[model samples]
Target: MAMKSSPVVLKTWYVSIACIMLLSALLLFPVRISLASPAVLVVDDDGFASPTDCDGSDPAYSSIQAAIAAAFPGDEIVVCPGVYSEQVTIGRDGLRVRSFDGSAVDGTPDTVIQPGELTPAAVLITANGVVFQGFYIKDATTGTGHAHVHRGVFVQGDNNVILNNKVEGRGTCRFADVGILVRGGGVGNGVAENNLIENNEVTNTCNGIATVSIATNNAAAYTTIKGNTVKNNLGIGIAADRTPSALVGFNEVTENEIGLKYNSDSEKGLPATGTKFRCNDVYGNEIYDAQNIATDNSIMDAEFNWWGSNTGPDPSKISGSVDYVPWLTAPKEEGCPQKGRMTGGGVLRGEVLFINKTKVSATVNFGFEVHCNNEKEPNNLQINWRVGGQTFIFHLTAMNYAACFETAADQGMPPAPFDTHVGSGEGRLKIGPSPWTPATIQWMFVDDGEPGVGKDIFHAVIIADSTSYVISGKISGGNMQAHPDDP
Candidate 1:
């Protein structure tokens, strides 16, 4: 009976013993992560360490330029595959070297680094939020006037983000070397965007992915080139010159004789007018082979892009001048191009020939000279005319494989054995009658011939070049005599 102490029940047992000692110090503490805020430094040419202590073992800072010189602004330097050999740079605050496992970089087929063994450009990144990804850089050797300025990823700095890396050997680059050489004052003003630089492949190198502009496009703006496939590169697969205002899309610039090259060294320095090149499939790229063509000036897609050029259309003409059309369901072994691809001589009706260079008078104005390489689809086209022996019963509502009907008919006339039996596919062409013009003519069913033996037998003229004519002789009845003055 001596207990009388009640200071409000000892202030509720001292606040329930300080809430159970703050839940047992939040279940035993030790989760404090913030290496001075946003850190991840890790290097390895064998367990490296520069200013050491980003933790993970430290072998005296293995080397990503000595852990990026002791990292700072949003630090993150993984780097571990090996063979760094070194040319290092990446200055100006902002780091991200990556590759602890995300995989991608080949720099030149798995890291080689020998531009005279080092001092070239193993990987000089100059920062501004730097982000280099994957890895693979090669021999790089240069000297013929900075020998293309060696690059495996030589970005100058400014919002940099060189992703998916795999730069090739520069093959003795003369002076504009590139694997990924983004330039322009203060590192092209940043914003290299999403960055996949995909599949990562490059060769010979003069430009695999270049974006120069030391002083244009008002100091270079938005850069976003997508997908990136660029093969064979001697001059371009993805190039944006001194006028740099890049935004090229999808990216699959094939065979590379020059798939996407836009320049402006001194055309008064233009470019920056919206700049957007879409979809991208860009074919074998010979750009129309005039010895690797130079000034045709379509300057990469003014829109969309397909220009592989197989052409057709314009059947008997009426309007259709080509803007792009050749996908014909795509798959006749995949070379399947056909919406239009026409060229020379065409007149598929009971084709049989004779046009008065004195070759026996069947010249009632039967013309054929097609050369329409499809400016478009010229109304899809169709030219049927089966007359007598029906040429395998004629049935070609026009699918246009460049419309063929050859047997050579204009002066020097002779070529109409049913246009060589339907152009070797052994079909079509066999019309009959009309020696003195009663208007039923078209022939070719010869075999001891004359006056209805097998029936159809005029089979007009439809020749295709390389001159060497002969179809079993005799088609010269002295101008079909009914008296061209008693020939």
Candidate 2:
């Protein structure tokens, strides 16, 4: 979205394989996901395309809706790579519908859900405590229904999670409303409270993300919209009001009409009386970065944010009573980030390796860091690997992995990016995701050879967690440089 920030860090902390200390933090901030389900329902587009295209004899479900219909309350559904042409709904509590091999990285998305026919939305949630992740949801502009009902991803349930997905072009056809909406007061739906909408990209809609209530006050309360990029929408990037005490934090809001807004429903007469916006990157809006048309003219807490200017937000860019003091001089950098990725502690650059002459495997082009090394630090590691047709992309924050480098004066090595380095550390080993699925893995690497001349090494072992691999490998192919830290 043309962000001016060079480094993006959002303070992510859901990692660590070295320390038994992470076990305590896991308990303190436990995601409501219980892997103790009866069975995992697998959905793939290999033999199915539509909701009814399931190959019953093949055992795998054909459509997302079919899996939901047959799933139990706590069951987890894993969907493979495909562009699904149907709308989805969930009525079962605690059911997780996730795309198989996708993270927050747009290069490799979870699954694609572009509804063929026009409906109210691409996905609808009336269930509580459901986890919807890893999908690229868009082209859902299919209805003339109410603003609340017409969205890319709409939620009327409580404690639900919307993570690591990209939602764009949502209300283009009819109600230009919201890309993702979390509202309360649905007749049969549960109260939309304490819902976490994190690590998602919302753009090209009327509004990016919103938490609201039409039934009564506090119906859609305490929504946490964090670690997301909200930009290029027609109206508000993030709208939190009508419902009370909603938090909009650690997000990048740019290139929109309004970066952040208070709920302005003249019909309901809700003036966004109580909302808190903090620690966000807000700028590049065509109109205003933050527009608070609160009828009450009450003071809103809009502090700790990066408002495109080190001095502070421009007076004309923000409206109403907003307290925007003590702002960040630069973009926020933590575990997870608002813009440019906060990569690993060291720099990892490499070339490709073709094993069988035809198969393109072992191609590494990424920067990784170990923020999971300490208990209090964020788990932010970014690694990209390709074996055959499969690529594993995950990232952690602040302190997970650790490594050291040998410079020219220190052991006669090359400078920074071209230095000889070796190190090993433990971490949860995920790229871009929630803490729900953590894999305990330890890894080691050596970049001791010349860049482009070959001889870089990489290896990993699944010492703990799920039953996966007792792995090892040898490599000597590179012109790439590896550093223990930035040059």
Number of the predicted model whose TM-score against the real structure is largest? 2
The global C-alpha lDDT for each of the candidates, from Candidate 1 onward, is: 0.43, 0.62
Worst 10-residue stretch by lDDT in candidate 2? 335-344
lDDT of 1 at 265: 41
- Compute the lDDT for candidate 1: 0.43
Considering summed lDDT, which 10 consecutive residues are worst modelled in model 1?
Answer: 478-487
lDDT at 159, model 2: 82
Residue 455 deviation, candidate 2, in Å? Answer: 55
In each prediction, how many residue pairs overlap at the backbone (N, C-alpha, C within less than 3 A)?
A: 43, 38
Tens-digit lDDT track for model 2 on 378-401? 334455555545555543322322
lDDT of 1 by residue, 231-263 (tens): 776666676554333555555666665666654
